[model samples]
Target: MLELEGIETGYGETRVVHGLDLTVREGTVHALLGRNGVGKSTTLKSVIGQLPVTVGTVRLAGQQISGRLPHDIARLGVAYVPETRDIFGALTVRENLELAGRLAGPGADWTVDRIVAFFPNLAERLNNGGHELSGGEQQMLAVGRALMASPRILMLDEPTEGLAPIIIQQIFGKLKELKASGLTILLVEQNLNFALGLADDISLMGRGQIVWRGDAAALKADDQAHARWLGV
Candidate 1:
């Protein structure tokens, strides 16, 4: 239940996203697919208030959120997992989750223990410093921190980036389970196979605009569409 209409954004004078539009339905995963420098992340930043919309509007369940502060937007049920693992290097894994929980306030869907349960490895390393964890573990910690906020919609940017294949599978599996449990997700991904495999709907973007949008499964049957729009 998020919508972006005619969104135009950029860093300073160099515009990166132009006239972007998309809708994310509740209880489903909507993917934003594009190559590098195509404004996929910029679009997300615009929606989440990291980058203000130069034009157009962003709405959640129909109310406008375009101009709200980043923290306010987050408080309104949008959780972001950035491409960079934004974990505190010196903080304990548990402490990170706790801080996230406190920042999001109470009444979150997932508790600290619930997050620990979902990530058992993190549970064992609860007191360990963030720097001590492996890359996969760090990724898990990032997701766990976001989950602690108990968001209504989760926007993940390259959740599988740099992870081993097995770890990626584990992460995707968990994401699928979350979708099954009614979590609406907006995913920004470059791994075509990975995005198509899990996305309910996929939109291919180029140069800051959506070039194609369709059911994820349909892309496989239409090689021409894939070749022309996705460059795959």
Candidate 2:
């Protein structure tokens, strides 16, 4: 479980996020959705300690982690897959997975073989450099690398960005499977349909604040909520 309250953060005093509050329960997918520049990514950065919170607190399973180092927060069972997919271009797929596992220490759930099994395409490209993979393959590698950390909670920013529709479906399928296996996901997504299909709850952000929050299905059915907050 993760909880954030009244979080204020910015890039060097030019505040981008203002008083944002969010909650993600254990074993559930929580979607944070908003238009561009509304601070979805900034909120995640604050939560993961990539950026310092100017106010309020971030707690994971009741342990405060707001200002901790990103590595420390990661060691506390939080894994982040940024929008850029952050893979090492020169590293082989196997090497990348191994590095992630080593960084996570022992007791990681996703072994290299297991990650390959989950992503058979990755197994096929084991010897290939990250730069040689297609966007979909790169995205899979990103997810696999994060899984190597064996996190209880995974935070993904735009996991489906720039992928083919079929690949997007595949990624969502994998996300569904992870959810069924008891992984708590905090997703910052632009694809509302994909997110709504998987999320247990939805929190819609506007102007760097949560203007709407509710059950995913209910919000999906509420035209007024969509019009007012999502503008779609």
Instruction: Give a tens-digit lDDT track for model 1, residues 136-157.
Output: 9999999989888888899999
Q: Residue 139 in model 1: shift from native, Å?
A: 1.0
Colliding residue pairs in candidate 1: none
Give Cα-based local distance difference scores for all models: 0.88, 0.92
Candidate 1 segments exceeding 4 Å error: none
lDDT of 2 by residue, 115-163 (tens): 9999988988999999999999999999999999999899999999999
TM-score per candidate, chains pooled: 0.97, 0.97
Q: How badly does each model clash, as a count of residue pairs? A: 0, 0
- Model 2 alpha-carbon miss at residue 114, Å: 0.6
